[model samples]
Target: MINTKKIWYLLAAMAVILITTVALMSNKKEVEKTPKNPYQAIDGAKTNSYEPVGESLELTTDDNVIGNKKAELIVFVYEDYSSPYSAVLAETLSRINSELDNKLTIAIRPFVTAGNNISREGALTLMCAQDEGKFSEMRNVILAAAKEGSLQEGGFNVYANQLGIDETAFNNCLTNEEKSLKLEAIMAEADKNLVIGAPTIFIANEMIIGARPYSDFVDSNGDAVEGLKAVVDRQLSAVGTKK
Candidate 1:
C-alpha cells in the first residue's frame, strides 16, 4: 500500500531544509564580502582598541629616524602621513625618546594608501626634506598641514624656508616620480607585513595597530598623548629580567 500523504509530507520537509541551507550559505557569503572597517581618518588623538597580534612580524629600517641606531629596542612605524593618528604617534615617540635619552631607535616605513593624495604627497615631501637633514622638522610641517586639512594645497612648503630648502626644489621633489616609486616599494613592504592601516607599530615581532595612549605604554595617567611607550619599557624590562 503506497502511503501518498506520507510521501508528500516527507518531500515538503526536505525541500524546506534545502531552501534554508541555501539561504544561510548565501547570507554567509554576503557577510564575508563586507569590510570590517571603513576607510577614513581617525579622530584627532583618538584611537581604536586593538589586541596584540603576537611577535611574528618582521620590520625594516629607514635613514629617517629619531633615536640611537644601535638602541636595544627598535620600533618600526608603518604610517600613512595623512592619518591624524600617525602624526600623534610620531610626537608621542619623540617624547618617549627624549625621556629615555634617545635610547629607542625609530624606523619609518611609509605606507601610502589608495585614494589619499595628501598622504602620498606628504610622504614624498618628507623624503625630500630628509635629503637636507631636516626630516623631523619637515615631518612636523607636513603633519601640521594634514591637521589643518590643507595637505592638498601644497602646504608642505609652509616649512620649506625653515629648512632652507628652496620652494622650487621642494615642489620638484614632491612631484618626483623616482621618490614616488620608492614610496611604492615601502608600501609593498607594509603589505608584506600584513599592515592594513596607518600608525601600526612593530616591536620585537609584536604589533599594535592604531593609536594608543602614552600611559598605556608606560606608567601614569593613560590620558597622556598617543603611542607605544609601554612596549619599549616592557621589552627592555624583559631583557633585564632575563639577564
Candidate 2:
C-alpha cells in the first residue's frame, strides 16, 4: 500500500528544506566576509565606535617604533609595504613624527596580506633590519625600493650593506622560518581586529582608511576636508588637557 501522493509531498518538503538550508549558509558566509565596521563611501577619517583593542593593539618590545615609545599619543599603523597608498601614508606619518617631535609615537605593524611576493619580502626585510636595530633606516629604504619597483630585482643585500646591517645576518634572517611565522601571526592579529585592507590606521579609538595628506589634517577655509592631522591634533590636545 504505497502512498504515491505522500511520497511526492515528502520529496517536495525535503527539497524545500535543502534549498532553505543552502540559502542560510550562503547568507552566513556573506555576513562573515563583510568587515566588522563596513567602510563608508565618504572620504577622510572614519570614527571607530568600538572599544580600544587593548592588549591586541598594544606595542610590543619588538615593534618598529619612531618617536617616544612611551608617548601618550601612539599612532598604530598596519601597512603593506608594496602598496603605493601605504607608501604615501608612510611619508605622511614620517612628516607628522618630525613635525610633532616627541608628542607622539608611530608604531609600525607590518603585514603581508597585499597578495604579492614583494609585500612579503619587504616585511621580511623590515623585520630582519629590525633584528639589527636598523628598522627605521630599513623601513625608509624598503618603502622607497617598493615604490621604485627595485625590491623585485632583489636589492635588499645592497640596501643592507648600504645601511650597515650585517649582510650575513640579514640574509640569514630573511631565510629564517621563524620570521615567516611571525609575519603570519601579525596578519592573524590584524584579521582579528577586523582590518579589511592595507594602510589601516588606529589613532586612539578612531580607525582611518586610505592615504591622507598633511593638509587633510586640517580644514581649509576655501575647501572642506577632514584629515589625520586634525585627528592627531585633537588627540594631542585632549591628552594635554588631561595633563
Best by lDDT: 2
Off by over 4 Å in 1: 1-18, 27-61, 148-150, 217-227, 241-243
**TM per candidate:** 0.73, 0.74
Q: Estimate, for each residue in 1-243, the C-alpha lDDT of model 1 and write its tens digit.
A: 879999999999999999999999999999999877533323332334233433354434454666898787778887788887887888788888899898887888777778877777777878888888888888777776666666664666767887799998888888888888888887776776668888887765456677655774432545433346666677667666876
**Alpha-carbon deviation at 193 in model 1, angstroms:** 0.3
| Candidate 2: tens digits of C-alpha lDDT, residues 1-243 | 889999999999999999999999999999999867444323333432233343447887757788888899888888888877788888887777788876778889986765677788888988898888888888888777666766663567888899898888888998899999998888888888777678888777666666766664333445555566777887788788988
In model 1, pairs of residues that clash are 55-205, 217-230
lDDT for position 214 in model 2:
65
Which regions of candidate 2 are displaced past 4 Å? 1-56, 217-224
Clashes of 1: 2
